[model samples]
Target: MNRSACLIFNPVAGQGDSEQDLAMIRAILEPEIDLDIQLTTEEISAEELAHEAVRRGVDTIIASGGDGTLSAVAAAVVSTDISLGIISRGTANAFATALGIPDTIDAACQVILQGVTRTVDAADCNGHRMVLLVGIGFEAEAVERADREAKNRFGVLAYILAGLQELRNLHSFDVEIETEDKIIKTSAVAVTVANAAPPSSVLAQGPGGIIVDDGLLDLTIVASLTRAGAIAAAFHLFQTASAGNGAERNDIGYLRAKQFKITTEPPQKIVVDGEILGTTPVEIRCIPAGLKIFVPSREEEEAVEKLEGLPNLTIEEKPSPENSPD
Candidate 1:
């Protein structure tokens, strides 16, 4: 009951995620909003559809796909007044989950009707933009190796297989990370520059401990480890993620910064949200409250309560980590 809205959906997002229930979506939304539902085909992607909605002055644009689709729509709406909404149809609804939106389509529709709004942060790397996360090294490699066919068949388990395969071939990168104050050098297996928690599907990863609204990117650096070290480090990340709420200094290498730069001795792959977006020496900056999103009052309350305890920490380390990878 706030304003008119548009839903840009990809029918092929999940297993048998079809248009059969689209009429139901329309019916549910019509009473509360002036609804326009766009079912995406191969030629016109949901991102393109979102841009079209923006051009028409639609106040709220709902992305109804997975993390990739959500990232695309967020990119399209960046710096625009149009708000973003989510309808989770992907295998791992990371963006939606980070926003704390319920997973079911009908449940999501009801939340949208409730019409509560929250401002969330975002990050930009080179040309790629994402809300939940951007990463390099092992994690990016897992994304590159993640199988689409297998994901459709096995759902979230597909990423598990891909991650295991990448772990075997995992190579550490000589990373020189500099902010505005200090320069720290480490050979890391993986580094995540995050805004929200990681994508919804990657529930078991280190970023499950990240909070979206805190105005800082949670810089998670997995220091280079031998086979035993890797397993130990992986356990630590899992344990800390599982424990959740409040963080210990060394348990995770956590940093909060407004802007940051990261460089590697050699180039590395980058995954923004769940989409691959080139390599490093990427410059990252946090846009505090950059997006307005629709959520139910319960979700809004939950997000508020969740972020209340984190300390407001920002870093500007010296020898700024900004440049294209050499």
Candidate 2:
């Protein structure tokens, strides 16, 4: 019996040679796997292609693009038995960074060939599938400013430039957050609902870090008023994130919940998994253990072992997709 796989390639994701990368992936996995390749011509094509691949009984669905492309493909495979693989070729590649997936073509292909799977949590926001965090206010503005031209020239620095510009004009808006246990009203400059995030995503960094399989969402709110205050708050959150601790600043609020509904006084743009979705008033619910993804076996196992002893956070469990909550 031969294994089957589908590679959904996004040609314009990052500054990489897609042709050469695909060839390398083929050379590495073709011998043992029946690999099928699909090129994405437009936005959301990867998701559609991934669904088709799953319907055709492909054992694994690999996304070869940036975070947006990967998010689209991951959305299709979530709640299904097929495992998701990544070949990072995007600007931030934040999802890949969170999973410790290598950005190199050969290294990424090697991960798929290694054949290790980890079931992770994914979330849904108003019918949109979310694998990483959703950002409102400052984060969304930063993403909006980091356009294609900037990304092509400056890479991740584009985001930094945009962020600095956004900071100068930051303003707080009233938001009401409804969770299973509580409803809170507050003024915030930024809010993040994170399923998984790398350390660089300082806003998503909670006390325990952003746990992908925790069955809960990490929410971080920034309520700073001044530019200096916002920068100070961000630095504090970054320090805590680096230390694997949740933010401990008075202006920065952090919490964990299974579900959340957020409504802003004035509608604000929302960025889900790197793509700007429409305005605010979105409902997000955690789909625990909904996604099975291929990861570096040894590194993931070691990280899991280290996390087992942590309090308030659950270690990864091999949960059945059928058991996923509706």
Candidate 3:
């Protein structure tokens, strides 16, 4: 049976030639699927177009951009029967990298053509849908520093350079984290609430790794005060993330919950799915098995695993056909 798909593409994502990429995608998918391509004009237009695609009863809505574009499209299809596909053309491509989605144009189109789907968890922070992690304090600052110009010039290295700059002026602020079980009051330099993340997101690393389909959010807080302590903590987290293990450091706090309300003394900036979304006193809640996404088949997964160094860090169980969207 032929499936209908709408590709909502962001023209400005990454440093790609959008026309060439689009042509490549169309060439790969058009033979198997009825594909419609739409270019995104503004920030939230992808979400609008995704909703329109859903209304047209398309079988899949593919986001052809970075994490921000993907999140926007996912927001429109969450809890729906429409399967979301990804074509990573963003700087970090963090969510795509985490899910073993290939960044190459041909390989990504191949994943969509293969058509394997998996149901995963998503969350709501304030009113916005969250498919990746949210960063506060240091991470947020780093993101702010890694502006569009820097990203266009330096790619992923922009984030590192920005992060290093942020580290120089890092300062902890009072925070109150409220979950159903407990309330934590602490002074922290960084906090990460992740629904899904790759091993590269060291701040969200935990003992059990980050389980995207587990119906919970992995939260990590770095409470290091001094610059040296913060740097050390960051290194520890990177090591833990690389190993796909829980944090074993004293300064790092790790936990999991279905919902969280975080408030900072001096309101800190919040970055959700790579877009900085203003200051926080934010509330977030998980919606388990809320999103249906295209993933690699078992055979393909194995082949990719052999080539990749780090584990997905967010996947606990093998993705089964039973987990496909309704």
Give model 1's clash tally: 13
* lDDT tens digits, residue span 1-326, model 1: 34688888787888763766566677788877887778788899877887888889888898887778877888788778787777787887777777788878898888888877778887777766667778788888888888789898888888878887887887888888877787878788888887887443232245446666777777877764665666676666666576663333242465667767889978898888888878888888888777888777864455544444568955565664675355
Report the lDDT tens digits of candidate 3 across residue range 176-272.
9999999999989999999998877777775437888999998999999888988788888888777767777788998999999999989999999
lDDT of 2 at 319: 70
TM-score, structure 1 vs. true: 0.85
Q: TM-score for all predictions? A: 0.85, 0.90, 0.90
Q: Which regions in candidate 1 have their CA more than 4 angstroms from the true location?
A: 198-208, 245-252, 299-326
Deviation (Å) of 25 in candidate 2? 1.3
lDDT string, candidate 2, 1-326, tens digits:
77888889998889877788778888988898887889999555888999899899888888998888899999998899998989898898898888778778888888898998889999999898899989988899889989999999999899889999998889999999999999999999999999998878877775548788989999999999999999998899888888777777888898899999999988898999998999899899999999999888886446644555667986578779999887
Task: State model 1's lDDT.
Answer: 0.75
Runs of candidate 3 with Cα error greater than 4 angstroms are: 303-326
Could you list the CA RMSD of all candidates, in the order they appear? Answer: 12.9, 8.7, 7.6
